[model samples]
Target chain A: MNSTSAPEPAQPTERIPAAERREQILAAASRVFGERGYSGATTDQVARVAGISQPYVVRMFGTKENLFLEVLARALDRLVTSFRQIIQEPREAGPAATELLASRLGAAYVDLIEDRGILLSLMQAFISGHNPVIGAKARAGFLEIYRMLRDEAGFPPDTIREFLADGMLFNTLLAIRLPDIFHEDPAAAELMRCTFRGKLDVVLDATAAESTDADAAPAPPAAGHVDAAKDDK
Target chain B: MNSTSAPEPAQPTERIPAAERREQILAAASRVFGERGYSGATTDQVARVAGISQPYVVRMFGTKENLFLEVLARALDRLVTSFRQIIQEPREAGPAATELLASRLGAAYVDLIEDRGILLSLMQAFISGHNPVIGAKARAGFLEIYRMLRDEAGFPPDTIREFLADGMLFNTLLAIRLPDIFHEDPAAAELMRCTFRGKLDVVLDATAAESTDADAAPAPPAAGHVDAAKDDK
Candidate 1:
C-alpha cells in the first residue's frame, strides 16, 4: 500500500482548497475522458483517475456531461494560454519570423499532446458537435483560437488557416492512434514520421504508458492527486 | 403516406437482387452511421433508412460494426474515384494548372458532401481510429488518398499537406455542426462563412435537412431504396 497517512475520508479536502481540488479532479478527468471518449468514459473512472471517491466526482461536477464540459473548457483554456505565451515572446521582424512563428505555433500545439488529454479531449469535443452544448463550445473555442492566431499573432490569413489545418490533421492522427499502428504499418509509420517529426517519441511514450496503465488498479482515494502529465510518461 | 408499394410483408425485396439490395442498405447505413456515430446507430435504424426490414440488414451485414465497415469502405472508394476523376482531367503543363487542380480537387472533395453521408461517413471513420479494424481501414484509406493527391494529383508536398489540412478542418466544422449555430454565434457564423466560402449554403441545407429528417418516421421496409441525397433536400 502506497498510503503513508490516512485522513478520514469525509474531510478529504481538509488541506487543499476547493479551487485547487477542482483543478486536480479536472486534470485527472481530462486524461480519463480524453483517452476513453465521453460516451465510453464514466464518472467512476474519472474518480479512480483523480484518486477520489465516486461520490466526490459526482458532487464536484454534478453530472458526467458537466465534468466533460469542464474538462473541455480547461483544454481550451490551456491552448489559449500556450498560444499567448508564444505570441508574447520577442522575435525578429520579417517574413522569416512569420514563417518561424507558424511552425512554432504548430509545434506548441503538437506539444500539447504531451499533456495527453488536452488535445485529445478537444478532438472529442470537436466531434461531439451533435450535442447542442458541447458543439457550441467547441465552435466558439476553435474560432477564438483562430482569431488569436490571426489577430494577436499577426499570422496572415492563409498562413493561419494552414496552421489550423495542420492542427486539425494532427488531432485526427492522435484520434486514430497512429502511433500505435505505426510500427506494424509503414504507411502509418511514414505519416507519423512526417507529422510528428521529433515529437514522435514523446507521442509514442505517452500512449504506450497508457496501455500499461490499463492494467494498474486505481490508486487509493487518499493517495493524493495523480499528476496526469508525469504519470503518463 | 409516401409508401405506394403493396408487396407482401415477408417479400420486401422480391424484385431487387441481393447484391443490389446490399448497396441500398450500405447507402442508408452511411447516412445513419455518419449522422449518428457508430455506437449510437442500430441495425433497425439503418434498415428503416434503407427502406428494408431489420432482419435483412442483420442478414446482410451480420453486425452493426460490419455494416459500418462496409459504409466506411464505400466512402473511401467514392473519395478515390472523385479524386481520380479530377486528377485525370486534361490540364496545361504549368504552375497555374497545378494551382487550379488543387482547388478543383478540394471542390471535388467538398462535392462529396452533396452525397451527404459520404463525407460525414469519412469523418466518422477518420475519428474512429480507436477501433482495431476501423482504425486500420481509416489509416490505410486516408494515407492512400494522401498518396493520390501527392503522386497522381502532382501537388507539391506542402501544398498537398495544406489541402489535407483544409479538408480535415472542413470535416471538423461539419462534425461540430458549425452550420447549425452560424446564425446565433458570430464566431461560428464567421468561421463557417470563411471556411465554407461558396459552399456555405449547401453545408447548411444538408444539416438542416438532417434535423428535419430526425422527426420523420422511418420509411416503410418494402418501399424500395430511399435515395438519401434526394430526401435530405
Candidate 2:
C-alpha cells in the first residue's frame, strides 16, 4: 500500500509572531470565559481553543486572572472604539445630536453582539464583581465607556444613561438567547418585536449567521503540533 | 459558670416548622448565591446563615440544583407579586395609567433591590444561562414576569419592553454597586442622577439603611450548634 500510494505532502506550519499569537489567544479566551464564566473556565480550555499549549497560554498572560482582565479590557476598548467611530461619522443635520447618537450607538452595540464573546464576557466580568480586583476593573471599565459617550461623543448624561440602559437590557436578551425563544414563546416574540422596533429578524439573522460561521471553522492546529501529535498517540 | 448566675434561665430554641425553615433557607441562600455565583456558593453557607444543619439544607431542597431553582422561582414570584400589589392599589386618576404603572413598578424594583439579594441573585441566575437547567429556568422566569405585565397588568408590549430595559440597566448598576461608587466617581454620580432623575439620594439612603440592617442582625447558630461548636473547638 505504501509503495503504490503517492507520498503525503508535508503540512505547512504557519509561524505566527508573538503579538499576533497574543491577540489570537485573547480572542479565544474571551469566547471560553464568556461561555463558562471566570471560575468555571480554565487555562487549558483556553489553550485548546486557541490551538496553543497550556504552558504557553499561562506564560503569555501570567495567570488566568490576568488573562480575564486582559479580555475584559479589550472588550471595553472595542466598545469605546466603536462608539468613537460612530461619533466620527458625518451625518445629515436632521435629528438632534443626542437622538442620532443614541440610535447610532444602539446600532453599534447590536453589531458588537454579533461577536457574542465580547458582550457576554464583559457581562461575566460585571457579575464577578464580588472579586475586589475584577469589581474595580468592571466599574472603571463601565465608567470609561460612559465618560466617552458623555465627553467625547457629546451625549448628555440622560441620553448616555438611557442608551446604556437599553444596551444592558439587550445584553440580557442575548445572554438568554431570547431570539431563539421568540418563535416558540409568544411573549418572548412580542417583547423582542417591541424592544427592537421590528428589527428582531435582522438581529436573529445576524446571530444565526455568526454562529454558523463559528461552527464551520475547523480547529486550528497547535502552533508547534506537539499537542496534536500527542493526541494522535 | 452558668449555675453561678442564679441558675441561668433556660434558653428556649423556637421550633420553626419545615415551611418556615424552607423560607429562611431560601432567603439566606439568595444572599449567598447572589454574592457568590452558583459555583462559588455551598449548602453549608446557606445552612449556617439559616441556623440549620447542612444535611437539613440539602434534605429540604433535595439538591443544590433544586435549591437554586427554588430560589430563582421565589425571586420571580416576588417580582410578580410586587407588581400585582401595585396594580391592585387604587390610583389617583391623574397621570396616565401607563406612566403611573411604570413609576409604581420602577419604585417596586428599587425597593426589591433594597434586600440586595433578590435582584442580584436573579441577575446572577440570568448570567448562568449557559447551563441548560439554569438557562431554561431563567428564560421561563423572565418570560413569566413579562407575561404578567402584558396579560395580567394589561400594559402594551412596547411599555413592557421599555420597562424591562430600564430594569436590566438598574440590575447592572446594583450588580456593580454604582450607589457605592457615586460619591467617589463623578461619572457614576452623574449617571445615577440622570438615570434616577434626582432620586439618587433616595436610593442611596435606602441602600445604606438596608446595609445597616443586615449588619445589625445576629448571626444565626447552626442547628444543634454542631458547626458552631466545631468552630469553637
Candidate 3:
C-alpha cells in the first residue's frame, strides 16, 4: 500500500535524493521492528514513522518482510564500512588491531541490536525452513563481507569452502540483538573478546607464514578430509 | 489443561532423578525443535522424539516454551562444563590454555548449533515480549552461570556486574544456532575463538595477580554506578 506516493523523483538531485528517502524508510523500519518486533509490526507504522504514506512504502518496498531484509543488508554494509575505516587508518597489527576491532565490532553490534533486534529475531525465527529468499539475501551479504577478508587472510576460495562464517555472523548478531544474554556477566564479554582475538591472530599468522609450494600436488586429500571431517558433526 | 494428570509421589532419588528427567526432556526438545521450527512443532511431537507420552511431557513442563527454555539452559551448561574442565586442569597459564579453550569452545559451539538450533530460535522468538515466564527462567539460569564464573574469576559477589556473560552466551548461542550465517565461514568461528581467548587471558591474569590489598577496599560506589550503567539499555 506504500507504492504510489514514493518520494522518488525519477531524477537526480544534489543528494541523489532517492538515497535519503531509502534511508528514511530503512531507519523507520528498523526502529519499528526493533521496538514492536517483526510479526507484531505493521507497514503503516513504518510508513508513518518514515513520514511517508503507506502507499509510498509499498512503492519503495513490496512488503514489511522485504523492507526488513533490506535494512539488515544496510546494517551489514555499515559494518563493512566500519571495518574498512579501521583498517585504512594505519593502525598497528597486534594488540592495537585486536582491541580496536573488538570495541568497534562491539559498538556496531550494539547499535545494530538496538536498531533492528526485531528483524534479526524474525530472521532467526525463520532461518531454518527451505525459504531461500530472506536467507539467501542475508547469506549473500555475509559472503560478500567474507570475500573481502579472503585476501586479507590469504586463503584460496576453494579451501574457504570448508569453513563456517555463519557461526561468527550469528555471534555478532546475537551479541547485539540479545543484550540480556551478553550483559549478564561482564566477564563473559571480556572472555569472548579475548577468545576472538587469539583465534584471529592464529589465522593471520598462518596466512602470513603460508608456503607457496604447499599446494604442489594437493597435499594428500586425507589431510583435508580429516580436517573437514573433524569439523563436521 | 495438561495438569489434569494425577500427581505422583515427590520421592527423591539418590542424586535427584528429576534432574535426569529434565535432561531427557531437554534432549528430546532439542532434536524436535532443531528439526522443525517452533511454530511447526507440538508438545506431542517433542514427547514422541523424547520417547515419552505427551501427557508425561505436559505434566513435567507446562508448555513447549518452558521445555525449550530448559533445552537452552542445558546447552549453556554443556558449554560451561567444557570450559571448566579445561580451565581447571593443572596446566600453566599461557598460550596453550588460550588455544585449548578456544578450540574446545568452538567445537562445543558447533555441536550445539548442529544439535539444538530450533530451541535457540524459539527462545529468541519469545525474548522480546509476552513470555516473561520463560524469559525469567532463562535469564536466571544465565545469571547463575555468570555469577559462578565471576566468583571464580575473583570478582566479589556484587562487584563485577557487566552483562559480558549475557553477551558471550548469546553470541555463542547464535554462533551455533544460526549456521546459515556461520557454516560457510570457518574463519569467522576462528576469529571469534581467538578474540575471546585473548581477552579472557587478560581477565584471568588480572585475577591471578590481584592481591589482598586490591580486595581490601570495599568496592567503590563508582562500581555500583558502573553496574547500573552496565545494566541499563
Candidate 4:
C-alpha cells in the first residue's frame, strides 16, 4: 500500500546487480525493521540504509510488509539450518543428555547477537495478529521451529515450549538493549548474570562490538549466507 | 515531541472532569500503544481514541513518550496489585500446593483478557530495551514481578525464569492474535489447547467477545482498578 511513485535514486558508484541489490535491501531491511519495527519502518528508510533507490526497493519487495515477511522467513531459515547442523554435530554423551543439546542450542541463540535483527525482527512479527498474511506466516514458521524441537530435537512439548519461551525471553533482553545497562541496574545485572552466566561476557562483548560498528556503519548483512554462524535460535 | 498546535478539538458534548479525563487518555493510550506499539503511536491518534483534543492530550502528557510511561506504570500497577490480592486469597491446598497457587495465577493472567491491552501493552514495554526511560521503567517493573514470584511465591530461579518466559510466550500468542486462528490452524489449535488447558474455551470466548466489542466499541479502559481479576501473571 505504498503509493509513493516518487523516486529517490540510489547514488551507487556503479550499477550493482539486481540480485545483489535485492540481497543488500534484505540485509538493510533486517536491521531497519528490527531496529525501527515493521509497522514503523518504511521502504524509503530501508532503501537509504541499503544505499539503493526507494523505487528499486518497492520494485523488488513490493511493500514494507512483504519485505518484513522475507526477513521473518530468513530468520526462521537461519534457526532451522542452525538447529539441524547442531543436531548433526558430534557431541559427548552424558548423564544429562538433553541438557547438552539444550546448552548448544542456547549458545547458538546467544550467538545470534552477531545478527541482532534476526531476533528483534521476529519480535515485531510475533506481536502482529494472525489474520494478516504476516501473522499466518510468522505463527506457522514459529510452529515449524516448535515442531522441529518436538520431532527432531526429541524434546517433549513442555520442554519445547520452554525452549521457545526462553528464546523469546532472550530476544526480549536484546530488544530492550538490556545488555548495555546490566552494569548499571542491579536487578538487570542479576537477571543478566543468571540468564547469560558464562556467555554474559560474550554477549556483552558481541553487543559492544556491534554497537561500535553500528555507530560507524550498518552491520554487514547476512546476505546470501546459509551458515551455522548465522543461526539465530 | 509532538509540536502540532493545529488542533482537532474533542467533540464531547459536556465537560468531563480532569481526573476522569486523564484516566480516559491513559486507558486509550494502553490500547493504542498495545496495538500500534510505542514507536508507532502518536498523540494525535491517542487523543482521537480518548475522545479528547490533541492539544489537550499534549497538555496532559507532555509527549507521546511520557504518555506511554504512564501507561506502562499503570499496567505494572495492575499486575502488582492483582498478584498481591491473589496471594492474599484463601486457597484449598492439597498434595500439590504450589500448583494451586500457580493455577490461580495462571487463571488471573487469562482473566486479563478482559483488558487485553494490559498484556499487549506490557509486551510492547518488555521488548523495549533498557536505555530509554521506557526501557528502564519496563525492565525494572518486569524484574519487580520476578522478585515477587521468587520471594513471595517462593519459586526457584529456573522456575521463575520459566514462568516469565511462559508469560512472554502467552503475550506472543495474544500479540499475534493466535487465539483467533487456533481453529483454523491445526498446529495453532494443538498449542492453544495445550497452553490454555482448562481455560481454552474461556480465552477463546473472551477473545471473541473482546474482538466483537472492539469492533463495536473500545474495550472499557481499566481506569484505577486494583482487583484480583486484573492480575496478569
Candidate 5:
C-alpha cells in the first residue's frame, strides 16, 4: 500500500497556478476529512472534491497524511488569527485590564462559536484521534491556546486559571454544536455567561485583596523559594 | 442484504449457560461497536469476538442495527445506575445540600472519565456522525440528561438554572476529554475540578441572589384580559 516514490518536479506545461490550486486542494481536503475522518477518507475522494486527479494531488501533497497535517495546521492558523483579531477589537477602552480581557475573550468566543461552528467540528475530529497524523498537531494547537490564555490573557493568576481554560474550551464546543439546545432556552447561554463572569470576578477580587494583604504582611525571604520550587519541581 | 431469519429461536444449547452466553454476547458487541463504530462494525466481527457462529449472533440480537442500539442503551443504563448510586451515598451525615451535590457529582464525573474512557470514544463516534443509528439514541440520551439536571436538580426556577444546566453538562464532557489532551500534566485533572467548582458556585450564588430579588419585589397581578386587543382584530 505504500507508494514511496517522490514524483518528479512539475515542468512548465504541467505547472498549476500556485495560490488558487493550493487553496482549492486545501478546501477539498478539509471537507473530505471532516466528513469521512482521516482513517476512513481516501485520496480519490479528496481529488474528486478538488476536481483534480489523484496523481496531481500526490504530486502536490506527497501523501494523504501530509495533506491532512497541512489542513489541520491551516485550521489552527485560522483560529489564532480570529482570536487575535477579536482581542484587538475596541472594548470599553478605559476598563481595567482583567475585566477588559474577560469581556473581550467572551465576545470573541461567542463570535467564533456562532460564525465558525465547522472549526469546532474540525478541532474535535483532530483531537479525538480520528486521524493520527493531524491529531498530534491539533493537540499542540489546543495546548498552545490554553497556555497563551493562561500566561498571556491578563487574568489574576490562581486556581481559577485552569478552570477558565477548561471551561472556556468546553462551553465553546456546546455553544457551537448545540445552539438549538440553548436557542429555545435563552437562559441556558445566559446562565453559562453569568457563571463564567461571576467566577472570574471572584478570582479577580480575591487576588486584588490578597495583593493588599501581602503589602501589610512582612516580606518573607522563604516565600520566593516556595514559588520557585512550585515552578521548577 | 437481509439474511433469512433463524428458525424461531432454536432450543437452548447445552454448550453454554444462558446468563453467561448473554454476558459474552453483550461484551463482544461492545468491543466490536467501540472499535469499528456503529456503521462500520459488522455482525461477523461481533460473532468472532464472541466466539460464536454468525447465525447465533443474529439469533441472539435480530439485526446489526438492533445489536448496536442494545449495546448503546445498556451502556447508558449502566451509567445512570452508577450515578444514582453515587447520589444516594451517605455524605458525612448532614453536609449542606449544595456541597453534597457537588462532591457526589464530582466523584461520579471522575469515575466516569477514568473507569469509562471508551465512553468518550463512543460519544465522539456518534457525535461525529460516524454512526447514525447510535447517534440518534445518544443525542436523545444527552437531551434527557440535560432536562433532568435543569428541571429536577432542585434549583429554584430562574434563568441561572439554565446556566447551571449547560455548565454541568459541558463540565462532564471536559472532565472526560481534557485529560487526553493534557495527558502528561498532573495538574490537568485538578484544574478541571477547580474550574467546575468555581463555575458551579457562580450558578448557586446567582440562583440565591435571584430568589432574594424575587422575594423583595411585589407580586404582579394576573393578566385576566390580555387577549382583548387580539380579539378586536
Candidate 6:
C-alpha cells in the first residue's frame, strides 16, 4: 500500500506555484480515492500523499465531497478528452472505418485504465450513487461518453453499445485483477484468453510497464488536440 | 435508503428457532451489505433489518466479515445452483444444445440479478479484493462459477468467456440503473436500447416485480435437484 502511495519528497523546503500545487494534490487525491474509495478516503491521507499539510488540503478543496467532485470531474474529463482525440484523428477511406474507429477508441480506453486511478475512481463514483451529487455526476459523465461515441464518432447505435459493453467487461476484469488471480487455473485462463482475445498481452504489458516508471513525466498530448473545457455542471 | 432497508417488524418479540433466525439474519444482511457495501454497512443496521438485537447478530456470525462471507457464499451458491439446474435439464438434440444451454443459463443469471443484493454484494466483494480473506473468497467464488460453466455446462472456452463478458456488462448496467437515468435523454436512450437489444424492458420489469414481494415464500427447488454441500474452503 505504501509503495502505491506517492514517493516522499527529496527536499521538503521547495515551494511550488499554487496552480502546480493544486494539480499535484489532485493527482495524489486521485490515487488515494481510487484505492480507498470516496467514503473510505481521508484528506489527511491525501495530504500525506501530496507531501502537504492536511489543513491546506481541506482549505484548497473546501470539503471532502468537493475534493471528490473535482477528482471525479477530472477523471471524466480525461476519458472524454481521450475519446474526442481519437475521433478527431484522420482515418483511411474504407468500409472498415467503423471497425477501425471502434478498435482505436477501445485501445484508448485500455490506455486510460493503465492509469489505474482513473477507472477505479470513476467506478467508485458510480457505486456511491446514493449521494445525489455523485449520482448526477456519474449519470451525466456516462451520458457524455455515450453521446461522444454516437454523435461525435459517428458510430451506429449498435456498434457504440457493443463497444461500451466490451469496455465494461474490461473494467470488471481489471477491477478484479483476474489475470493475476486466474493465471494458474486452466479454465479461468482460457476464459480470460477469449475475453481479451489478442489484446490481453498488450494491455497487461502496458500496465506492467507503466507501474515501473511511477515518477516518469506525463506524456504530451497529441498535436492539434485541445483539452475539453471542464463541464461545470 | 431507509425504504430500501428491510421493513421494521410489526411485532418484534416473536421467538424463532436458531436455524431459522440465522437464515433470516443472513437474508437481511445480504440486503444491507448489498446496498451499503462491506465498509459502509454496519451490524446494527443488519440487526435492525433482521428485527433482532445487534448482539444476536454478532453472536450468530462472530464478525461483520463472517456475516459478509456467509452472504457472499449464499449468493454464489444460488447462482451456481441456478446455472447447474439449467445445464442439467434435458435439451433438444443437435449442435443447438450449446446455444440452448447458453440462452437458458443467461436467463438464469438475469433472474439472479433480480435479487439485487446478490449481485451487488458479490461485486462489493470483488472490489474489496485487497483483504486477503475477501480476496480469496471472491477469487474462489468466481472460479467456481467459471468452472461450472465450462466443466458442468460444457460451454467451449470462447462461448463461456463471451457469456461472462455479456454478464459483466449487464451487471454494470444494472448497478448504475441506466434505464432510469437515460429515460429522459434520446441519444442515451438509444445507446441503452442497443445495449440491451430489446431485453432491457424485461430486466427492468422483473427487477421491479421482485422488489414488491420482498418477503414472499422462497421458490421451491426443481425436482431431482440435489443441493451441493457448501465448500468449506
TM-score of candidate 4 on Cα atoms, chains taken together: 0.79
Worst 10 residues of 5 chain B by lDDT: B211-220
- Provide the interface RMSD of candidate 5 in angstroms, 1 decimal place: 6.2
The order of the candidates by TM-score, greatest first, is 2, 6, 1, 4, 5, 3
Error of 4 at A140 (Å): 2.0
RMSD of 3: 21.2
Ranked by lDDT, the better of candidates 1 and 2 is: 2
lDDT of 3 by residue, B116-155 (tens): 4433543443343223454555555544555554554344
Docking quality (DockQ) for each candidate: 0.47, 0.58, 0.04, 0.41, 0.07, 0.38
Q: TM-score for chain A of every candidate model?
A: 0.84, 0.80, 0.49, 0.82, 0.54, 0.78
TM-score of each: 0.80, 0.82, 0.48, 0.79, 0.58, 0.81
Candidate 4 stretches with Cα past 4 Å from truth are A1-15, A51-56, A88-100, A212-233, B1-14, B42-48, B51-56, B88-103, B151-154, B212-233
- Among these predictions, the greatest TM-score belongs to 2
True contacts kept of each: 0.57, 0.72, 0.01, 0.50, 0.04, 0.44
The DockQ-based CAPRI class assigned to model 5 is: incorrect
Local error of candidate 2 at residue B64 (angstroms): 2.1
Superposed model 3: Cα runs more than 4 Å off: A1-23, A32-60, A85-131, A152-233, B1-25, B32-60, B77-133, B153-233
Tell me the spans in candidate 5 whose CA falls farther than 4 Å from its real position: A1-18, A40-59, A88-100, A113-118, A130-132, A156-233, B1-15, B18-67, B86-96, B114-118, B129-132, B156-233
Q: How large is the interface RMSD of each prediction? A: 2.0, 1.3, 8.4, 2.3, 6.2, 2.1
Q: Which ten residues in a row have the lowest lDDT in candidate 4 chain A?
A: A211-220
Please identify model 1 stretches exceeding 4 Å from their true place.
A1-24, A51-56, A212-216, A219-233, B1-21, B51-56, B154-156, B212-216, B220-233
User: What is the C-alpha lDDT profile of model 3 across A1-233, one tens digit per residue?
Assistant: 43334343333222337777888778767655544444445677676565555677777887766887776666666667765665455555674554454455444433433343333543442342223465555555645555654554333443233232323333422323323333555644444344344343332233234222211221221223544556433
**Better model by lDDT, 3 or 4?**
4
Q: What TM-score does chain B of candidate 4 reach?
A: 0.82
Task: Show pairs that collide, candidate 4.
Answer: A176-B128, A176-B129, A176-B130, A177-B129
User: In candidate 5, what are the lDDT values of residues A1-233, reduced to their tens digit?
Assistant: 12222222232223459677887778767655654555556676666556555677778888877887787777667666776776666666554766667656655554443322235435444334423445456555655655556655644434235334444444432422333333454544444344444443333232233211111212222234554566433
Calculate model 4's interface RMSD in Å: 2.3
C-alpha lDDT (0 to 100) for residue B116 of candidate 1: 67
Q: Per-residue error at B223 for model 2, in Å? A: 15
Q: Which ten residues in a row have the lowest lDDT in candidate 5 chain A?
A: A210-219
Which docking class does model 1 fall in?
acceptable
